[model samples]
Target chain A: MALHFDPADLAARRQAACAAVAARGLDALLVFRQESLYYLTGFDTFGYVYFQVLVLRADGRMTLLTRAPDLRQAHRTSVIEDVRVWTDADGATPEAALRDILAEHGLADGRLGVEWHAYGLTAAVGQRLAAALEGVAVLEDASDLVSRLRLVKSPAEIAYTRRAAHLADDALDAALTEIRPGAFEGDILAAMHGAIYRGGGDDPANEFVIGSGPDALLCRYHSGRRHLDAQDQLTLEWAGVYRHYHAAMMRTIPVGRALPGHREMLDVTAEAMAACLDAMRPGNTCGDVFAAHARVIDAAGRRAGRLNACGYAMGTTFAPNWMDWPMLYAGNPVVLESGMVFFLHMILYDDDAGLAMCPGQSALVTDAGGESLSRHPVTLTVAV
Target chain B: MALHFDPADLAARRQAACAAVAARGLDALLVFRQESLYYLTGFDTFGYVYFQVLVLRADGRMTLLTRAPDLRQAHRTSVIEDVRVWTDADGATPEAALRDILAEHGLADGRLGVEWHAYGLTAAVGQRLAAALEGVAVLEDASDLVSRLRLVKSPAEIAYTRRAAHLADDALDAALTEIRPGAFEGDILAAMHGAIYRGGGDDPANEFVIGSGPDALLCRYHSGRRHLDAQDQLTLEWAGVYRHYHAAMMRTIPVGRALPGHREMLDVTAEAMAACLDAMRPGNTCGDVFAAHARVIDAAGRRAGRLNACGYAMGTTFAPNWMDWPMLYAGNPVVLESGMVFFLHMILYDDDAGLAMCPGQSALVTDAGGESLSRHPVTLTVAV
Candidate 1:
């Protein structure tokens, strides 16, 4: 198998997932999220764009129903034994095939947990599944069942995150080295990603968020390339991925001499980041982290420029986003635990000044506090 | 605005969308798909990971409901003047905010179209939306309303695709030039992506499908990297993106001497691809293209080695996938239309032979026939 872990480790993960399913009074769990599937059975593929389902029983049995193309994919990448192929013929219903699998496993009349909040299970697919099993079974929206279980990381997973963090540091170094007054934003991005791949990183979960000038105030990737001016601001938010695990980082760099306001904003952002890190220990709530960030910014008279959340939990994820659940927003009740990965960005954008100062890093939650995975200094760097 | 098109073009697109909404007898259309939202108003951001929606009224008025971070993003990238920000407070319900928007627009007592088949609208979110709008409005599943309109590309969209196709050819050339007997797959991928970015290409919707040696028998990208063997086979399927428009290409390369089976498979793949391209005309159905592919493969006695679908539609799309609507599968009745972009991949994998010969390219459907976008030769390349 193409799995990084041993078969025993994969089995233990599946066992834990089954226990979670049984605790929730679900006889069978329909896993839809690609991250959750990879965590449980090592079933890695982009075939989730098509209709594919992994059914895990309370008795520790698992079955994968997928299209013909993914049959070999599942065989090579996952430990799923009972694989079934769903044809793409006209009037073909993979949902019915799923129903048959449930019937064969004696789970037709039992409660089924479906991942209704996942990327793969759209509303139309959910409606079709409900219509197919209306008279035969009961479906419950257990969307967060597997996600919450995956919030805390294991030692092995943490190792992967640390490696990814190192790669991210290398990527940033490459970007800093390539940045100049006349450098194109696209060229810098290319250098950063090239360093990441050379350092043995996988594909990132989202596009690298890079922009310059006024576009730097906006935190998304646009199409065209722009040449940096003599005194310009470039904002970059990217991740280093290892085995689908992400260690995200963000930085705003000045091309030439730094403006006084820009330097002040950077100092404030660093102070807020420190405060957030201090609050990210075991037994503290996610709200506590946000409160710390807010308190630091408010005390510095930058409350108006602060955002609601300062960070979010991160782990194995798919594209369209790398930010995971249990966001550090106000009054979020999720308690921090040891071995949790979090990305904290103290983003302070002064629209009037037309400048942004966002400095962020990924850290691992420990007994004392959050230990930063990235070793890069938080001080603002000016590219000369 | 950061939009590629002028304000008038955006206005005209919104007018067409409003006409469609009125024709369907809907008071307002809630668009959650990133592609549809981008096509309508040029509001491009990955912030859709949060709850964001574009509400288009039947009377040509539009409002964007998004988070605070994306407010400036909307103003900078889109022509949207009416923007609402949803708070991330403890008990903040964005769906209720959506309900309020509908109520303010007099759409509380009318039929509304919801894109239930989209990536953003998960089942749980849809259920929440239904509960929020219950007893006030009728929520109809009009998922295909906007997607069908996007099937036929505009002249401007096709221009972007053509540019993207040229970049794909350049990327392929870079990949071939870098591939050697001892080179790591990761480094090769880095070179290709670096070339794409340097050539002014955007991030692709899907991860580049790349593998070598035994891994070449598998399709999707895996985590680990492997060194190329002297007689190894490497398969690559990647796309060049420009302004979210994708032009995909695929190839199977031999590291050293080409085996007899490899050469035979490549010949058959090229013949099948030529036939498929010949069948892709404006008046033909998608099934006709599939028939041509099947005819060539079956004549070679390699019918069992082929996949179900040869190609799919392509256009402006976001992550998780680039394959668009109107897939070229057997018995599919989607009529080929002028100004449509299609990616046809002739994939043939023989597990017993431990070999694969996949040759593919993107094309534009014209009144006479399909015009190949990629100028790369279909013949197999040996990188010795």
Candidate 2:
């Protein structure tokens, strides 16, 4: 078995999870998040898109109920011994199968914690599960129990994150070579992804944000690839992934010449990013970091151009994005810790002026302050 | 604006959706699926990962409620005129915003259709939405209403599918050049993706499945990659995407020398694939196609190796998977129709012998039968 983490580490994680469940007075946890499954048992598969769950009792006893496609996957990639399969038919209700399993494990009438905020647990399936266990058990929304535990990374996870950061820098280096005028955005994107794969990195949890010209003002990824104009702005938000752990970075590069006030906005963004990093002290809250960013941008009189949220936590995540819990927004109460990692982005989009400037990178919170994981310096280099 | 589909095509799709909603006695549809939003308005963004929905009324009026990042995205890429932004606060409940929108549209007490199967609508959010609108509206699970309409491709959609198929073939051509003894799976995957991007294709809905060694027996994408041994089996399942329309293909290649009984299994898989295609004629149910595959595989005494379901219908899809509605499993009653695209995969994995064989391709259903979309033939090639 090619388990990503050491068996001892995984065992420790399972023990901690069991302790958490016991502390919450829950009999078991119905884990529907793929990240939690991978972190606890090393069970890795995209089959979570279907009706799949890992039941972890307070005593650390575990069982996985999944589809036929992941039957072999559970056996090969995970340490869990009890793996159950649910057949697919026209009206296959796997929740019924799960109820039977709960009965077998003497938990039919027990209180269970559920990862209800997970992408794996769609509303339709949740409704079915609720109905199946209506008179049997009490379902509690303990969606962030595992996520809170994962916010503080172990040493091995940090090593993987650092490697991912290196790959992110390498991807940016590759993109710089292909970001000249008249270059196709598709080719630039291909080069960036190819660099990560060649460096033994894995596919990112989400699509990279690549937009040029007026589209550069947008932050999300959209379809359609266009060639760079002689004078254009290109915004890129990409992550390097290794063992499913991600280190993301964002930047908006100018082709040929920078836009009006673009250089000044870049300076303000850099200052704001520095302030956010400085606010990532061990005693500070996530809101402090966002406040720092907002203070700098608002003081610069660029409030109209700034995004409300600066950035978010980053770790091992699956599709549809790499953003983790404890987003850096105003009034968030999450406290910063030494091992916590974050992506701090200062994005400014002047809609009326059709100009954009964003500078961001991943950082690991340390005893002193925040330390950048990436080797790339934050600077606006015009591509000629 | 860079709308992928023509304005007329989008208008027609909206009319069809409105008709479907009215037929179901629904006053409005709360579309949570990203594919539905993209099909209805060409509004493309991964922002659906947040609390975002497109509200379409029976009268053909549409309004989008999304986060700040997609405010520009909806305006630039889609034809939607009304785009509302939701702030990202600590205790923000966008469901309340949705309720207010419904009330303003005079649908407070009206029956509404909800796409409950969407990844964007997590169980937690669904619970919140239900609580927020309790006694104010009636919600119905109309998950497949838009999906059934999207299953059958229009002429314009077919053009994009054909282009995607060409890109899939090109990706395979590139993969073949890198698949040899002692080849790293990462490099081969990079080559395939690079080829697709160079051909002006978009990012696929999910990560490509690539496995060698014993992992080749598994069907789902898992973490960790391996190198091809001197004599190994490599299984690859990938798709080419054009404007979110997918044409997927799967193949299991042999390295250096074929496994024991592998060549015979390949022949059996090919024969079974041919039977499946022939069974996809008009008026035939999806179950009939699966029965044909089962007949051929079981008759060849390879029942132990074959999968329960052969393939699934494919069209415009979003993250998590490219497989659409109406999977080709036993007893499925969905009838085949013209312009419906299906990916027919004949997968065989013999655990006893540790052999794997999968030969698959996308095809469009016609009045006559299924026509293969890919130019690449279903034949096993041994890499020396």
Model 2, range B246-358, lDDT digits (tens) per residue?
A: 99999999999886688999999999999988998889999999999999998998887335789998888888768888899998999999999999999998888888999
Q: How close is chain B to the truth by TM-score, in each candidate?
A: 0.98, 0.98
**Candidate 1: residue pairs that collide:** none
Error of 2 at B238 (Å): 0.3
List TM-scores for all candidates, in order.
0.98, 0.99
lDDT string for model 1 (B267-348, tens) is 9999999998899898899999999999999999997743588999989888878988878989888898898989999998
List the lowest-lDDT window of 10 residues for candidate 2 chain B: B301-310
**What lDDT would each prediction earn against the true structure?**
0.87, 0.90
**Evaluated with DockQ, which candidate comes out highest?**
2
List candidate 2 segments past 4 Å from native: none
Instruction: Name the regions of candidate 1 deviating beyond 4 angstroms.
Output: none
- Residue B149 of model 1, lDDT score: 85
lDDT of 2 by residue, A204-319 (tens): 88899999999998888888899999999899999999988999999999998986678989999999988988999998999999999999998998998435789999899998
Q: State the weakest 10-residue window (summed lDDT) of model 1 chain B.
A: B302-311
Each candidate: how many clashes? Answer: 0, 0
